[model samples]
Target: MSPRQYEDDDAESLPDSRFLLPQLRDADTEDVEKYQRGGLHPVHLGDIYDGRYRVVHKLGAGGFSTVWLARDDTEHRWVALKIVVADYSTSVSTKSQLSCHAASRCASDAVFGFVLERRHFTLDGPNGRYLCLVLPVLGPSASDLSKGIYSRITPSLSRRASYQATRSLADLHAQGLCHGDVTTANILFGLLNIDRYTESDVYRLFGAPETAPLETESGETPGPEAPKYIVKSLNFLSSIESVISQDVRLIDFHQSFLISLPPEQMLGTPAEFLAPEVAVGLKASPASDVWALRCSIFRVRSGEGPFSGFEVTSPVDLLRIVIQTLGEMPSSWGDTLFDYYGQPTKEPTKGSPLEPVVETGRVRLEDRVWKEDKKKPYPPCLSDTIRKPTATKINNSYIDGYSYETDELLEALPKISENEAALLYDLLSKIFVYDAQKRPSAREVLSHPWFHMGEL
Candidate 1:
C-alpha cells in the first residue's frame, strides 16, 4: 500500500512523535530506544536540516507533529518548521490542492486580507525519516489573544477578525475546499518581525521556550544554548500594542477536506465546532465550515461559544449539546437514517448514549434548557421542570460546572450599536440554522449586511 493508505492505522504506533530535547539524547540506552519508538528526531539547539534551516527553539508540539522556530540561514529569515511522521504527511492529492491554491493567489493578497505561505519537503530525522513543512513565522494565535492581554477581544477587534476570517473562508470555498478545523487556536496574528522584541520579552509575552537542561548520570553537563541574535531596542512592543486591526489568518489545514472527494473520506473536526450534519454521519461540506465559522466568531465577539457551558465528554455528548443548542433535527435528516447503501437500519446498541438521541427523534425539548438532553427514554406524560427522570437514568456526566453569571457569551458580550447588533445576529442565525442546505455559503456570509454595514 502507499504511505498515505497506511497512515491512519500507523498513527497510533508513533503517538509521542516530537523533537527530542538536547538533554535526553545521551542520557542512556533506554532513552535512545524510547526516542526511536516514539519517532522523535535528535533535533537540538543548533542542528541544521536540508543544508539550509538552523533549529532555533521549539514552537509547540501536538500528538502527531512538532513545530520549531528555525532560522533559514540561506534566506536570513525566521520560519516555522513542522515535522511529522512520513506516513501522516500530506498526500499527493493534497499537495496538488495546496499547490493549486498557491498558484491562484499571490504570496500576499488583498482577497484574503492575510498571508498564507507554506513549503513542504521530506527530511531524515534521527528516529526515522519524516516529512517537514516550512512556513512563515507568525505571532500568538487568536485564542492566545483572547486569553492574554485584553482578557477578551474588544468589539471593534472582534469585528475586524471575523471579517478577515470570513473573507479567507470565502476564498477557500471558491476553490471548493473546506478547512476541517476552524477554531480560535488556528487563527494567528501577523507579526512584522521576530527581532522587534528581546528574547526575554518575547518569552514573557508569547511564552517562547528558553532552554532547560536535564541532569546527566555521567556528570558531563552542557549549558543551555543562548539565542544567536538579540534585540537591544524594545520600542516595537509598545508601538504595536494597540494594533488589533492587524491581519489574522486561518491555519492548520491537515484535516481540511476537498468537496469533490467522497463524503466517507472526510475527517471530523474538533468536537466543539462539529456541525449537526457531521455528528449524524453526513459528509462535511462548505456549509459545515460555515457552522464552525459562526462558532469561532461567536467566541471572538463574546467570551464563549453558544454551547460553551456544556461538559462534553464524548462525541455523543456533543450531539446532545447540538440538539439542545439548536432545535430538533431537521425534517430532511430523516432520510439519513438508512444504512450507507440505502438499506434499512439495524437496531441501535441498547443503553448507548445514541439510544436516547435516536429514540427522542422529533421531540423538541424546551429551547435552551440546562441539563435537558441527558434524560433517559421519556414517558408519554412528562413535565419539563421535574428533576426526576422516568425509567431512564439521565447521564449527568455532561454537567458543566460553570455558573450562569460567568458565561461571557450569555452575560459579557460587549455592548455594540443596535444596527451592528441586529446585522450580526441575522448573519450568525443564517449559518447556525440546523439544515445544512439552508445555511449560507461562505461567499453569501461575506456579503451579509454586517460585513457591508461600514459601506452604508
Candidate 2:
C-alpha cells in the first residue's frame, strides 16, 4: 500500500473515500512515533531523510502525507518532499479501517498520474509511497500577500495573479492535461527576487517540526499541522513590493484531472469552486478550469472567494449550490470584487470592510525587537499589524514564517476599477467557456487586451 495524502480540509477530501479514513486515535502515540519513526534522520539544524537532502523545513501536512523542504545533496538546492504514512492521522481511529490502504494507493496513482503529464502535482519517488516534489524555493503565495503580511496584495495584484494562473492553465490545456482542482491551496505564487531582503526577513516552515507545539506533551497539534513539516513564508521584505510581472508558475496537481475533460466531470473539487456541469457527473473541460480559475482570481482581488465562508453539511447540499450559482455564473459570486481601473468603479453601496481579512486563525502583528534591543524596531516596510511573536525568526522553534521578496512579483500599486476587473475576468473567461472549441489557447490569452494596453 502507498502512503495517505493529507487533505487541507474535509471538503478538500473526496466524500466517497475521505470520510472512511479516520483521524489518529491518539496524539501521544503519534508524537512518540515521530521520534521513533527513524526515517526522519535528524540533524542539528533539523531532521532529514538522507545525509544529502537535509530536511531544513516543512510546508504543510495532510491526512496521509507530510511535506518538507530538503536541500539537494548534490546541488545544494531547496526542494519540497511529501512523506508517506501508514494511515490517516492519529485522530481518526474510529473512521475508515480501509482508509490507510486506499489513501496510499490513491496517493501513488496521483503522483504518477501528474508527473507523467509534466503538470504540477506531488513529486514522485521509487519507494515508500511518498511523492516528493522539488519546487522552486520561490516566495510566499498571494494569500501571504493578501493578509497584508508582505507587499499589500491589492486588487491589481490579485487580477494579475489570476491572469498568470489562467495563462499557465491555457498552457496546460495545450499540453493535454487539465488541472482538475484549482484554489489558493493548490496554486503557489512565486515571489520575484526582490534583492532588498534577505532570508532572515521571511518566515520559514510555519508547520515544520522546528515549530512543534510547545504546550502539547505529545508534540503534535490537535488537528492538522501535526507531524508538522511545511515551509512557512515570512511577512516583511515586501513593503514596497510589486507583483511579479514576469513568468508566473502555477502549482499543486494532486487533484489535477489529466484527460481532455476536466476532472470536475467525474468527482468535482471542493463545492466552493466546482462548476455547474462538474456538480453533476459531467466531466470538466478546459472551460471548467476557466470558471474555477476566474473564481479564484476574483476572490484574490476582492479578498474573498465565491464560496469563501459558506459551509454545507452534506454533498447533496453542495451539489445544489454548485448547480444554482455556478450554472448561473452570477456577478453575485464576486461579492467584494471592486475595480481599480484608472478610475475607481462605484463602491458597492451595500458596504463591507475596505479590505476585510479572512482566515481568522490569525495572530495579531506587533513590533519586532531582535537582539533584545528595543532600538531595533521592526522594519518600516513591515506593517505594525504583523502576526504576533513578531520579529519572526528561523530559530529552532516549531513555528516558521517567510514573506516573498522576488522582483518578478512586485506590482506597482496602480489605481485599478470594476470595469478593469470585469474586463480582465471577461478576457480570461475565455478559458471557462463551456465549449473547449470556444476556449482561447495560451498563445491567444497572451495576446489579449489585458496584456495589451488598449486603453490604459
Candidate 3:
C-alpha cells in the first residue's frame, strides 16, 4: 500500500500526515470544495505567511474568510490571521481605513475594546490574491459562552455585557459608523497576555489540532489549489467566571458601513437579528443597529431571540414573525412591499382600530346562597353561563398570508423574571417599530432603567 494509505493496525506507528493526502470519513470541517477560485485560499499547518507569521492551527471559518492562529515571529507573539477570500479582498482598503479610525479612538479610551486591524498584507495564490489581516488573539464568542442547557449568563453578567455592547455601538454610531451586522457571534471576549503562551502551553490549553483528509467525490487526488487535509477549528476552553469577568470586543467589520453613506446592497446580518425596516427593503442605519442591539441583549439575557423559535426561510417570513410578535407594520412600509416583490397590485384589507376589552364583573361565591334539607343535603347547581375571554386580534393585514395570532408568538419567548420581562418589553417596544427613524440611538438606550436596574 502507498505511504498515504494507512492500515487500521498501523495507525499508531504512522508518521505525521499533515502534508500527506489520506482519505478518511467526513468530520466537522470546512467545505473542501471551497478551495476553488473565488473561495477559501488553501493553507497548511506550518505554512509561513509574509515571511513572518507562522500558521500554528485553525481558529475558525466563515462564508468569506478563514481565521488561523499564528505566531508572529518578528514580535514573538501569537496572533489571529484572517485570510479573506479573493472575492472579498477588494474591501480590505475600506476595512483598513475604518480600522485606523477605530484604533485611534480605542487608544484614547481604554474602557471599550474594539478589534482593530493591527496589520494586513496581500498574498498571491492559485485562486487569486488574498488579503491577510493580523489581529490580537481573543477568547470564545459570547454566543458560544452563553450556549448550553441554561443558554445564558448570570443576570449581573448579562447586564454588564449588554451595557458594554451598547456602549460599543454608541461609540461607533458617534463616529458615523454602523456595524451593519450585530449578533452574539461577533461579540468576543478579550483575553489578557495570550501572546505570552508558548507552543506547549497552547497545546495543553487547546489540545492537538484535529484534521481530516480532503478527497474528491470521484476518488481522485485534489488539486494543488486545495490543502491535503482540513483542520478542525479549535474551541476556547475557559471557566464561566473568567468569561463573565472579561471585557467584550466587537469584531467583524466586513458588513459595517458609514451611516451617512449606507451600502447599496443589503447587509449580511443573520436572519434572526435582521431589523424590520431592513427586512422590507431599507438601508441599514444607526436605528437598524439599535434594533439588532436589542435582539442581541435579549439573546444575552435569554438563550435566544424572541423570534428565534420561528422558522424564517425568507425576508417575508421574517417580516411575518416580526408582525406577529410586535403588532402590525406601519402603513408607510406598505409601499415597500411592492418594491420587495417587484410587482404587486392586490389591495390588502384595512386594519381595524386597536381597542381594549373591559371585563364586566366576576361572580362572587357569597352572592349564591345554597339551602340543604335534613334528608337530602346537596349544594345548589349554579347554572350561570361560562364566558371565554375574547382573543385580542393582531392587526397584521399588511402581509397577505399572515395568520399567526399575537398570543401564539408571545408564548414562544424565552422565560425571564417578570420585572426583567417588563423592562425588556418596554425597551423592545421602543426599538422594534417598523420605522427605523423612530428607534432610539444606542447612546439613548444606555440611559434606560433596564441598564441600571439595581447595580452595575
Candidate 4:
C-alpha cells in the first residue's frame, strides 16, 4: 500500500509506467540472427553482466532495473533476466531505487530462486544486493495479448482462454509458488488448433447470434474447423489460442513471501491486486492468493485495464476499491459471475497519473484531472496526454503512484494465481490459523481449494 520503502528525504526519484518499461527490443547479436528480433534499443541498468546472463541486448528498462530477454548459453535456455543498476554516484534517489529492487529480488529469490538455481546461477553485481536472477523467457506480457498477437493458429479462440488460465493457476498451486502478475500478456498460450476436429463441432461451441459477421457464401453454421469460434470468444480482449496459452507458473517472487501468515493479513502485492490485508502489512495465505486471482479473472473477461478511470493511484485507495466493491474477499466466486468486477471503486484522485497531456476537440478524462478539476467531456484520443494508458504501463505506474490501479492491474493479470481462488478470503484464515506458527504449509494451499474450475 505504501510506496516502496524509501527515505523521506530521497523522494521524487520514482519512475512511472511511461518511464519504466522501455520499448521491447530484440538483442542485436549474431547468436540470434535466425530468430526474429523486435525493434528496440537496449537500455543498460546496474553493472551489466551477471555470470551466465551476459548483457546481450536489453528488452526493456524500468525503475528498479532493466529486463533483458537473454540466452542462458551456459544453461541452455532463454531467460528474462532483470538487472538492477542505478547511478547512485550522483543521485541518492537512484541508489534507493536500486536498493528497492535488491530487497524485492532477495525476498523473491529467497523463496523461488532455487526453483531454477541448479539450472542457473546467482552472481554478485557491483552493489551488494544488486544481483541478477533468471527465469524462463516469456513472450509479450498480457497487455500485448490484449492488444492482440499471442498466437498464429486459431483465427478465433476464447473458450480455451479460461480453461487454460484456470489450469495454469491450478499448476501454480501444485507448486508452492503463486504468480503474482496474472495479466493477459503474462498468460501465454501454447499452440491450440481447434479445427483438428470436424467443422460441425466448432458451431456448437461458438455460434453467437451476437457478433461475428457470417459470410453470405457459407450457407450452414460454421463447424469446429472454423476459427470463428475462437474469434467470437476473444470479445476484444483475447482469442482462444491466446487463452489456452494463459497457463501460469510461479515467476517474479519479488512480491511473493513464503507461504506463511494469516489469511486476511497478506501484504506486499500491488494496489490493484493487493488482498484486503496487504495494505496493513499482514501475512498472506492461500485464501489471499484466491482473492488476487478473482480480480485477475475479471481483467481477462474485460479487455480494458481494471477500473480504468479514477486517479486514486495509492495503495490505500486501491484496497478501498476492493473493500467497497466485493465486500470482504471471498473463498468462492462472488455471486458466480465467472468473475466479479464487484462495485464502484472510488473515483480517480486529482493527483492521479491520468492528468491531461494534450487535447483534441472536447476535454477528456485527462483534461478533468490535468487541470485539477472535473474533466470536460471529449472524444476518445484527445491527445497523447488524454490517451488511455496501456495495461502494463498502468500496472507498473500503479505502484509508483500508490494508486488504486494496483489492485485493478492485479485483477487484470492474464496469468493465474498460485493457490486455488476461493469464494471468500477467510477460507485461508480457517486453514492458516491466525497464530503465525499454525499457518498451513504452502503445499496444503493447493488441495484445500482445488475445484477444477478451469473446465469453465
Q: Top model by TM-score, which number?
A: 3
Off by over 4 Å in 3: 1-28, 102-107, 148-150, 238-245, 337-415
TM-score of each: 0.67, 0.52, 0.75, 0.42
Model 4: CA > 4 A from native = 1-54, 61-63, 73-77, 84-118, 123-129, 147-162, 171-250, 261-266, 280-282, 327-456
lDDT of 3 at 342: 23
Q: Write the per-residue lDDT of candidate 3 for residues 152-255, one digit (tens) a residue.
A: 46566677778888888888888778888899888887776776678877777666788877776666777878887888787564221122234788888888
- lDDT, residue 300, candidate 2: 62
Top lDDT prediction, candidate number: 3
Q: Each model's C-alpha lDDT? A: 0.56, 0.42, 0.68, 0.35
| C-alpha lDDT of candidate 1 relative to the true structure | 0.56
lDDT of 4 by residue, 355-412 (tens): 1223223212323212111122222221211112221344344222223545565455
Model 1: clashing residue pairs? none
Q: Please give the lDDT score for candidate 3.
A: 0.68
Worst 10 residues of 3 by lDDT: 382-391
Clashes of each: 0, 70, 0, 56
